[model samples]
Target: MSAVDVYLADQRAAIPGPSWTRRDLLREAGDHLEDATDAYTAAGYTPTEAEALALRDFGSVDDIAPGFRDTVAIGAARRTAVLLVLVMLPQAFLWDGGIELGASAHSAAPDSGLFHVLDIIIGYVGTAGAIGALVALAVTAIGQRWLRIGRRTARLTAAWSLATAMIVPIIGFTMLTLTGGLTVLLALSALAFMAAPFALVALSAQRTLAAC
Candidate 1:
């Protein structure tokens, strides 16, 4: 394309956009490319504001940095954060069973079709809340450089992970007819994951903010 479009894309990439103006990216890129010609403009890039953003989007930096450590960190952190979400995949079904059990224990006739779906919804909501809190924590930690927050969040997530790790024991216990502890282990898992959710929300917003 022309100089204007190249600069515009660079600027857009830097600031972020499902919507943005030429002026916004221009401002975000430090407005340096305003005077350059298009062909040479997109060329000779050396990790300027725009380049950093493009790099963040996964452009190759083979000869640029010693290694793509930042990018790798970005991918891992994002995926792990996503994994927190994936961890709850079966929660809905499990929770639905819980609801159905509760209803049956009380009286099956009172339970409506809606309750089955609502049971899953309740479980998924809990899982979502925990995940959301974690994202919020990550954004505050990573973007703001909170001295202790990142470490704290990492620890908490580890705890959550460890709690879930005990699930194997629960199933093993069931196999061995010793399942009482399953409830306790699951409670621990829920607690650890629920300890932080707002942080995860922040993390989810990080990419959009950094671009701007």
Candidate 2:
């Protein structure tokens, strides 16, 4: 049998409940495995057969959550992604024309005093992005070697980071649709998109630690 096939077979046996079946394992684990294929490269384990081996080592579905509980545990993921977005919301407004909320602060002319707030906001965003990236990577590292998390959550976090990065430009443009780029609604949505990854990382890391 191919390594993936072997994984599928073992997943059925590994799961604690009888309701779990091969089809469910493939649906969840297959996607999770595909996302994790590059993990070994990150881990300094460059086995020519690393992808196959990783599939073979993938832990049980129950280890992650019940087979039927696919979306059930994702509440934590959502919260985690949100926190990461919050980290940089202020910076996002500063870089975008978002602060032009129809007030003196939004004036086109340069204001001596207000410039300080802009600098501070930008600095916080810079620091938050760097720190969040580092913490996410560390969690991902621990997640890969230890299936205690099934590491799928880490991939969700990775994909969230990539997707959130893509969202920044979209949000900047979307702000143009409104009267002021930084109207309250636009600001909230922008921040929501930006902080998505941190929510997944925070929740998964929490779950992984709790598993201990």
Candidate 3:
């Protein structure tokens, strides 16, 4: 294949977008290659040499495509963030369930210090995770110009934060159940059922960001 054809294909594979946008980008890239080839040919280079020189002057697909890919990543991250929040919203109503369970577990024994501590740990950790995820997702939506963080960093932070947020409460409640509190049985059952949804969303978000 010709040098321009190869470069265009590489660029298209490296950076994804709408069909019309990709076509427009490829068109612009083709024009640049043609102009560069003409300049090299006019400078007395052979056709083959001119094409090679044109491609070299245009820059590698790896280098040229990253900017476009980063832009695409931002958009992908934004959509994923919204989906993550939507999935997690139902879990909010379930928060009081954990609190009630923990409180009941605390009342089961004269020395329920560990249960209290675990309850506090769950609250603090969950809050931190939620905040971190939201901030990371917001940074992604705002783009690099506003946040100055890379797309990968933002994505990783958001994904891990969400995972932590989803899993910590369940762990805390499960531990509370060990304190001889039968009331927490219902809470534990509820959390067990919710685990699948949490894992599904977390894994999906991680894979999506890693692809980005």
Best-performing candidate as measured by TM-score: 3
Q: Tens-digit lDDT track for model 3 on 106-186? A: 534326676667767766766666566566567776645666655576467546645774667566555546556546565
lDDT of 1: 0.39
Q: Report every candidate's CA lDDT.
A: 0.39, 0.47, 0.64
| Candidate 2 structure, TM-score to reference | 0.29
Least well predicted 10-residue stretch by lDDT in candidate 2: 67-76
In candidate 2, stretches whose alpha carbon ends up further than 4 angstroms from where it belongs are 1-64, 67-109, 141-143, 146-212
Go through the candidates in order and give the clash count of each.
21, 9, 0
Residue 21 in model 2: lDDT = 32
Q: What TM-score would candidate 1 get against the native?
A: 0.29
Pairs that collide in candidate 2 are 80-198, 80-199, 80-200, 81-196, 81-198, 81-199, 81-200, 84-195, 85-195
Candidate that scores best on lDDT: 3
TM-score of each: 0.29, 0.29, 0.56
Estimate, for each residue in 77-151, the C-alpha lDDT of model 2 and write its tens digit: 333444555544554454445654323224232344444554454455456554665556455445335545433
Model 1 spans with C-alpha error above 4 angstroms:
1-67, 89-133, 136-163, 166-176, 179-212
Local accuracy of candidate 1 as per-residue lDDT tens digits, 111-149: 455545544554455565456536744653464464423
